[model samples]
Target: MNHDAYPDNYIRGILNSVKSIAMVGASPVNVRPSYFAFKYLAQRGYDMIPVNPGHVGKDLLGKPFVASLRDIGRPLDMIDIFRNSSHIMPVVEEALTLDPLPKVIWMQLGARDDAAAAKAEAAGIKVVMNRCPKIEYGRLSSEISWMGVNSRTLSSKRPPAPTQGMRLSINRMSVGGGDTAASDRAAKNKSEQS
Candidate 1:
């Protein structure tokens, strides 16, 4: 798979097939991009397990922050890397240790390791580098276009209405947990500003 030119079907296939994600290098801070990405992906229906040694035994958005991928104790379809590009090899190594290895290893924007990607791909794992799942979901699902972001592919036909009852959860343990309330509040504040 060419990381430089991923076709829509290839990207959509992975996103559609994945149900659970373990986000390594997740953060507790609200202003960080990882935090926002975690919240968005979770709300979009992916069971998000946040991995951060610094926040081990702590909770983020209702889900317990695991110290490492091995501690997740459940099957993860994908592992989204949020660390620096230089640090991806170790993360991929750890991911490869899992009994039922994740189907995909996604390196977030600005983070890419060709050697690590090749290793994972050799082991029969799909790899996506230098891309963000949240952004891809929005772009593929046309949600970004709704926000007036120029997504490049336009159509005269109206997009379908968004599904209702998709509220962000605040009590990290709730069905939609993790500082969701904070996200809601931030959204509300933004709406008020408008």
Candidate 2:
């Protein structure tokens, strides 16, 4: 896998496949990025476990904080590391100890340790560095785009939410494309400016 640039399909596949996520360094504070990311994913229906020793007894998004990944007491599909790059190795090492082993190890944006990623990859687990699953989920689902974020990627297919007004997900996406009218409008606008 190229750490520099990941294909949209690669990321979409992981987001669709993973049902459970353990976020290491998750914070109970509402203002923190980890807190926001955790909440967003939880709302998206992924089983989110907050892994932080500082607030072990406190409740995080209705789930008690777990001090470590091993305390999750169940298998995880992915582990989102929110710690600094220097601190990533220990987390990945612990992730490898899980009974069933997590399928993917994702290092948060600005957090990447090549050596640690190598180790995880060697163990047959997929590794994604310097990316946020929350942002990836939003971009792929068009949630960000709808909010004027210009995700750059567009799809004509209606979001397969299974219900009205719920966010899109790759799980139900059979095809990837753009809304041709929107695409043409944007292209024409750019040409006129030039």
Candidate 3:
């Protein structure tokens, strides 16, 4: 498949066929898109493994995080990458070294490395560039917000929304004083419940 243009059918096939995904550069911070996307995929019943040197040995959503693909020590169906274009080559090289190479190499939106993608494609590995698997899965499955209305069905009880004071707390927390605001929120939630 062309690295620049993957047919929709091919992309859909990969999404439907794969069971487990190793997410490289996944961050623990909930604010990051990588974290949200990874969390979303995991919640949707896909086996999502986080690979990040910084968080190696830590657990994200109960799945153990490994530092690199070589250390994962198991079969992976795909590697959904969140690293920069310049950093992708090494990851691809590592993936190639696996005894049974992964079926797909997915580069996140605005995260394409053409040369690296081509190398993987040359090895018979499917390449998906400049796209996010979470978005694609949700779109193709119609599991959530199919109309872009931000309304999605809940599998369980929905969580509370951020308070209106969330914005003020966000600004204050950026400068390192947000714990106090968070405490206030906890009290507010407790009071409202009572």
Question: How close is every model to the real structure, measured as TM-score?
Answer: 0.81, 0.83, 0.73
Clash counts for the predictions, in order: 8, 1, 0
TM-score of 3: 0.73
Relative to the true structure, candidate 1 reaches a TM of 0.81
Residue pairs in clash, model 1: 61-172, 61-177, 61-178, 61-179, 62-172, 62-173, 62-178, 172-178
Tens digit per residue, CA lDDT, model 3, 15-91: 77888899999999989989999888876667899999899778888988898999889999999999887889999
Off by over 4 Å in 2: 160-167, 171-194
lDDT of 1 by residue, 1-194 (tens): 87654655667778888989999999999999899999999988899999999998788899999999999998899999999989999999999999899999999987778899999999999999877898878776666656875443434555456675253221111122222346445544553454
Model 2 TM-score, 2 decimals:
0.83
Instruction: Using TM-score, rank the candidates from best to worst.
Output: 2, 1, 3
Which candidate leads in lDDT? 2
After superposition, candidate 3 runs with Cα above 4 Å error: 144-194
lDDT of 1 at 149: 58
